[model samples]
Each structure stands twice: as structure tokens, then as C-alpha cells.
Target: MSTQQPENTAPADRKVILVTGASSGIGAAIAARLVTEGHLVVAGARRTDRLRELATSTTEEAARSGGALEPVRLDVTDRADVAAFVQGARDRHGRVDVLINNAGVMPLSRLDSLLVDEWDRMIDVNVRGLLHGIAAALPVFTAQGSGHLVTVASIGAHEVVPTAAVYCGTKYAAWAITEGLRQEVDPSIRVTTISPGVVDSELAHTITEAGAAEAMRSYRAHAMGPDAIAAAVSYALAQPADIDVNEIVVRPARQR
Candidate 1:
């Protein structure tokens, strides 16, 4: 193995990373941390204003670390947009080393509440969105013979609780899909599923069920910050090429 650098190639350690749902919460934190670690981060989200602010902050810090951030307006539910986003990164950076499928929704409610729209939103964003990401990135990863797919699932994937039936179903589907991809793909292309527990994030804000919203308020009392999940993503990405960390579950110490 040679430690030689090619004349027209980026440093081996510098990776072109693409992250979805990056306007805030875990996605934003992941983008920031990746930039801090000297990786070029392409962040995608639906909120242009928040993405603009993140770009400004990332730019300021990038000036110090020589890393960069490219913010793009994205709606994960839009399959074409997701493909275009990944294509744009590949065009700009020559290759995308990693894709973080982090865009998700959590509109929890009891089945009796019959929030059918909310259920649709969760299915669209959490399940279909993840599939879109994989559809967009898998080809590129295969073409390059190497790439990483990191999914931000939830502890809901592993357990069922009151008021989270549909949300849990989505997470479970996400986990199963990610694991299935891992098992089916070439080993050189890594797949990692990160399941976080009770993180302090904007996900709770989307809950429409009055009772569920109130329950989340109490549930989030000791939740960990989004940065904790971001760190877990970093840990998975920093591993050697041959070492694939298949799954990670991160939770606050106080969470049951």
C-alpha cells in the first residue's frame, strides 16, 4: 500500500459527504461535525432560511479548518430532487464518499386519533425518503466500488410504545431496509444504521396529537443533544475501510 498522493486527486483523508435534512437538529450537527473534521459537507434541507444560516456558520468555521459546506434546498419526499442533489454533489466534487439519509418525520399519535395525514407524512418522509436516498446513492457507490450509507433511525425501531405506532413502523422499516441493503451490497460499500434514543430535537415539534405532544415534553426532560448522534455518525465514518460498523444505538444516560 502506497501513501502516495496523486497530482490531481484530493487527499485520501478528505471525503465529499452528502447529508439530507440538514437545516437543523441531528442533520445540522452532523454537517458541522463533519466540516470540523475536515470533510467537505453538502447539506440538503427544505428550509432555505435555516440552511442559509447554517451555511454562514459553516463558512466561518470552514475558513479556519479549510473544509467547506454547500447548502441546497431539498425535500426528501421528492424523489427527483433527491437524485439531483446527489448528482450535483458528484458533479461538483467528482465523487461522493458518503450519503447520510437523515431526513425524517415523527408525528406521533394514538391510532384512535386517526391522524391519517400525519401517518402519510411519516411514511413519505421516513420510509419513502430513505428509499429515495438509497436509490440515488447506490448506483454511485457501486460505480466507485466504495461509499458509505448512513441512516438516522430511532430507538423506536427496536421497541414499541404508546402513541408512536406509526412512527415506530417507519423506523422499523428504515432499519430493516438499511440492514437489507448492507447484506445485499458489496462489502466494500458500507452501510450503517444509527438509532438514537430521545434526542433533544425539532422532531417533537411536529407532533400534532395534543396528548402525544405533552407526553414528549415530559419524555424529553433528560434527552441528549443532537450532537451526541452526530458524534456517533462521525465514529462510524472514521472507521477503516474494511471495518464496517453495521449499527449503533445511542441514548441519554437517564433514558430508560
Candidate 2:
């Protein structure tokens, strides 16, 4: 994996934050917002080219905010890769303050359509991916006695819709896992789940089913920008240590 250091060191109050699947959409927005907030953000994704583009786009703002954006090649589906990603940040920064498990895939299709491969793909990237993040970061957070784990889930966690049974199952799993972790972990380690609805993102593009794709086009017609979800993340992270923002659901006004 390729890694690049920032031009300037982070300020005293800056945090070392790790964001997975940060090449575009909600993950990219979160990484950019955190960097602008004076955080040393380690942005990782399978798309190294897009990661580099994100870093370049945020360079001036990061520099001005006493923050930095480091692009790293990463695949959340690989357990060893996630472990290395977390360890590499700890090795460089001495401590990792936060981890945003924003990696996910949504290929909406009905069960009868039997797109088994796409279903498995969702399970791999959505369910196992989240578990891998927890496995990699929980130990670090436990040892540090102070850390934050944020899961970018979906509004599907709360409701099921046509062509989204599998996707909603995966998201529900993400929400349950995050909630379970919150209950199990100590108070020193904060946990949060951000569920977004009908946001403009590349997730719909993954749908291989023609019917599902057509439906999503209409569903996303009134979608909000990815930055709105990023703002929710920022709000959760900005709260005082005593306050643990458990769950937040964000959706477009027109999205019922």
C-alpha cells in the first residue's frame, strides 16, 4: 500500500482519524470534513487514484487548519489489510483517536431475483467489513482507554423496502453490531452509528438488476448531498467526552 505524509504536522488538539472506503461519497466527505476540522485524517480506499485526488483537493484547507490528509491504499474486506491499516496509523501517530468504518456496498435486488453473488458481496463488504474494523480497532481502543468508533450505516437498518431485502439485512446487522459494541465497551471508548437515507452516492450504481436500478433512480431523485451525512458525523464527534451520541438518522426532507 502507498502512504504519503502531510507537509505540516498537526496541531496539539488535532486527532489521528482513520476513514475506510474514503475514495468517494459519504466516506470521502467525512474525511474531508474531519481534515478541515484540524484532524490528521488517514483516508483509505481500494481506489488509490481517487484517494490521491481527494488529498489534492483538500490540501490547502488541511494546511490552513493545521490538519493533514494521508491517502492509503486499503481494502476493508481483507482482515490483515485492516489490521495493518490501523497499526500503521498507530505506529506513525503514537495513538489513533477515531476510526470511521464507512466501507459498504448496496446492490439492491429482490430475493427471488437470486443474485446470490451480489448478496454475498453485500455481506462481505457490509457485515464482515464492519466486524473486521471492530476486530482491528477494539484492541487498540481498549489499550488506549480512549477512542471512538463510528459506523456509517444506512436508513435501511430501520426499514425494509422492495429490492432491498439483502441490503437492509446487512445494514441492520451493522446497526446491531455497533449497538452491541456500545453496550459491551467501556465508557471511555465511544461508539456511534450514523444512518443516512436517500443520499446522492454511487451505491445505487452497484445495482445490477435492471428493475432495481430503475427504481433507485426515482428513489434518489430528491436525494441530499453526501456532505449532510458528513455533518452528522462531525456533530457526533464534536460532543464532549461525557456525551455518547448513540445513533443519528439523516435523510432528505422529501425522503419519507
Candidate 3:
């Protein structure tokens, strides 16, 4: 005779998570996936209409699975908006569990193109925007004595490519800064760095330089899908609370 045993499963505590740049692409994908996982997600982006659509769709899907979403209009470039959104999330959820800094721009251009304006925009959004998220969420994490910060850097941060030097530089800074944040935060605070290689998204569409745009066409041809990243992020969060997944790089197996 054998006695039946119950399967052990982790308790599902509703985790409050904020995901930025969520109007489309990877950010939106992460937000959508998390919502489906029973997490209370605060999805944000500059495009209010797109954000609204994503929110509604997410809510409807979540409702089917017995969950919901909280949407907020945010331009991560605006420090005030970042701060306010963090505060608002805490107001609603009672505490912050995770912050996914996913807003970024890949307006790749060769140095010869001298698209310094595009360079600046990439830096402002990819680097500074991530910093603002850290600044906004760190305090909340510190107060709670526990939290998680996930930054979506790029594989370009690992290998510099044609017409991607400056964009890579910004990502390099982003990777460095996020690592620094993780080192300084409390042991209870988990930090995950998700560096994905070319992903099927609108990321390349932002490239303004003609040559750079053409160059990226070949790269996107080999890029991975955004769900690969969404899965990575979800895995990082699903780990035991004490574990801090310092970094996870999901690049195409075909990528060099």
C-alpha cells in the first residue's frame, strides 16, 4: 500500500511590479506576461493611447485568469513622472516588489553620420531613464527592506557593432550602473540584469541613419523574439526570494 502525497508548490503572494516602456515590444511583453502570472503589474510608457490599449487588453486577459492590471502614463525620461509613479504604485499595492527598467532607444548611427542628437536621445532614455527608475524605486525598497530591480540592457553592451558604438556605450553605462545599484542595495533586494540579443520588435525602427538602419536589417534578421526575454524575466522573479540573479544574458544561439 502507498500513501498519496501532495505536491509542494510555492505560495502565490501577489507581488507588485512596475514595468516601464511597456507600450510595445519587450516591455509590453514582459508586462503582459507578468499580469498573466497573477502579479499586480504597473505598466507605464510615454504613449498613453498605446499604454491604454495594452492595459485594457492585459486586464481582460488577466480577468480570464482571475487577475487585473494597473496602468499609468509615464515618460521615463521625466524624473518627476518616475517618482510619482513609484509613489502611486506603493499607494495602491502597499509595497513595491519589482521594478523592470525596460525603456530604451536604439537609434543606431555611425560616428561618421554624426547623429549626435540620436546619440543623446539614446543616452537619455537607455541610461538616464534607467537611473531615474532606480532613484524612484530604491527608496521604496529601502523602506520595505526588500525589493527587486530588473534592467533590460542589450547584447550590444557585450559586443560593439557597426553603427552601434554610441548606443552600445549607453548600454554599457546602463549595465555598469545597474550592477552598482545591486551591489549597494540590501541583501533582501534582488537585482536582475536581462541583456537580450536582437529581438523581434520595433527597436530597430528607431534607427534614423540610413546606413545604420540598413545595417540593422541584417541583425534583426537573426534577432530573437521578445518572449525569450519575457520568459527570462519571469524566471528571475520566480526564484527563491534570497537569490539575486545578478545577470541573465539571452542572446540568439546564432548570434556571434
Best by TM-score: 2
Cα lDDT of candidate 2 equals 0.94
Tell me which of candidates 2 and 3 scores higher on TM-score.
2
Better of 1 and 3 by lDDT: 1
Indicate whether candidate 1 or candidate 2 has the larger lDDT. Answer: 2
What are the C-alpha RMSDs, in order, of all predicted structures? 5.0, 4.4, 5.2
Model 2: per-residue Cα lDDT over 1-256, one tens digit each: 6556545655676889999999999999999999999999999999999999999999888877888899999999999999999999999989999999999999999899999999999999999999999999999999999999999999999999999999999999999999999999999999999999998989998998999999999999999999999999999998898899999999998987
Distance (Å) between predicted and true CA of 37, model 3?
A: 0.4
Candidate rank order under TM-score? 2, 1, 3
Local accuracy by lDDT, each model = 0.93, 0.94, 0.87
Alpha carbon deviation, residue 6, candidate 2 (Å) = 14
lDDT of 3 at 41: 85
Once fitted onto the true fold, the runs of candidate 2 whose alpha carbons sit more than 4 angstroms away are: 1-11
User: In model 1, which range of ten residues has the least summed lDDT?
Assistant: 3-12
TM for candidate 2 is: 0.96
